[model samples]
Target: MTKKMTWNEMSPSQQTGVLVTGSIQLALAATAWIDLAKRPAERVNGPKALWAAIIGINFVGPIAWFIWGRRR
Candidate 1:
């Protein structure tokens, strides 16, 4: 089995890739949450509360929200 690497054990490029990917995920989630907050109940395809929770998931959640959550 492969061993897990800690943050300190990762190389600079690997670290940078992780950071960048994490930043993108956070941004997408934040944008989805913000849209949910500002949008009306009727404007959203599903329950806002459900979307709120789903937004916490990684890239998939936010992308799903953007693609299928909104009425538009």
Candidate 2:
């Protein structure tokens, strides 16, 4: 079985990397959510409510919204 390391057990570099990655994901999700909110309902490919639900899904959700939610 693999052991899990707590935050205190992680190296500084590892902790920094984790923080950076978490920040990026948060930014991506936030940007996607804001864009989804600001976009007019008629211009979106589907219902705004549906897209809102999707944007809350985490990294994959926001990426999917950018890839498929917006109308070209």
TM-scores for candidates 1 onward, in order: 0.95, 0.88
lDDT of 2 by residue, 13-53 (tens): 99999999999889988999899989998879989999988
lDDT at position 48, candidate 2: 91
RMSD of each: 0.7, 1.2
Could you give me the TM-score of model 1 versus the true structure?
Answer: 0.95
* Candidate 1 local lDDT, 1-72, one digit each (tens): 999999999999999999999999999999999999999999999799999998898899999999999997
Candidate 2 yields a Cα-based lDDT of: 0.91
Candidate 1: deviation at residue 4, Å? 0.9
User: Which candidate achieves the best lDDT against the true structure?
Assistant: 1
For model 1, what is the alpha-carbon lDDT of residue 55?
A: 85
Worst 10 residues of 1 by lDDT: 52-61
The reply for model 2, stretches above 4 Å from the true place, is none
Give the distance in Å from residue 16's predicted Cα in candidate 1 to where it truly belongs: 0.3
Which pairs of residues clash in candidate 1, taking residues 3 or more apart in a chain or in different chains?
Answer: none
